[model samples]
Target: MAGTLTVWKFPTETGAETAVATVRDLRRRRLITLHDAAVVSWPAEATKPKTRQLRHLAGIGALGGGFWGLLFGILFFVPLIGAAVGAGIGALAGALTDVGIDDKFIEELKERITPGTSALFLLTSDAVLDRVLDEFRGQSPELISANLSHEQEDKLRRAFAE
Candidate 1:
């Protein structure tokens, strides 16, 4: 099966960074395959934070790059009252919604991940869920899984929404 695009929101930047590093360790041990990964950290003082693309993972292509770019664009580039620009971006985001990532989700994430928080965006496969969860047991991160069926997504959400 193709891997799912998963976003895990961590309450702290350190928690998110730790998750990414642990995933990297798993990848190094050949336990999982990470297609691409990025980390977003928004400090309380900064207006916006950069979404950093990890170096060791495979290419995420233009679609993934554009998706993240558009997210950051909406958060930092578009003017607050630029209806025309907002509509254009909305249209583009709507078009890409079928691709499994969209503006609505992005906006929801924007609301959920506030300043002083962080998130991990990962494209992964062959994950050992037990092991992965073990690494994060103490952190209690919130998960927002994408590219999954409604049932699957619901199950995942219920499992990690703590």
Candidate 2:
């Protein structure tokens, strides 16, 4: 089955880190199948976000550090360098687009995950949506983006609304 790439934004800098435990629990319960996960935490006083890949939890077919590095570079570093590195960043962004993470998704992430906020990036498949979402009821995470069909996305939005 195809995996879904979902990004969830949280209001607090530590929220994404806390959510990792919840995701682990869900995986343990067989409610979700996680291929890989990463957390991006940006503190209010920091100049840039801190990224951590859940290497211990990575399963087969997981994306390597290079993928995450290139993506994070495009999202957080490319703009800072201005036009000098535009060509290189463009090629990296294009590679990400080839894998379903397009410019719109990157832009939205850059806009939403600002200082004092955090985001959880999940590569997963075969989720028991209701059960898994129930585990995150009180966290108030916003579903920023997802590689899901229109119907699936609508269902996810409705679930979050509930």
> How well does candidate 2 match the true structure in TM-score terms?
0.86
At residue 39, give the lDDT of candidate 1. 82
Q: Model 1 clash pairs? A: none
Q: Candidate 1, residue 46: CA error in Å? A: 1.9
Candidate 2 displacement at residue 115 in angstroms: 0.2
lDDT of 2 by residue, 51-94 (tens): 98888777665666766777788888777887968787897677
Which pairs of residues clash in candidate 2, taking residues 3 or more apart in a chain or in different chains?
A: none
Report RMSD (Å) for each prediction in the order shown.
7.3, 7.4
For lDDT, the strongest prediction is 2
User: Candidate 2: global Cα-lDDT?
Assistant: 0.78
Angstrom error of the Cα, residue 127, model 2: value is 1.5
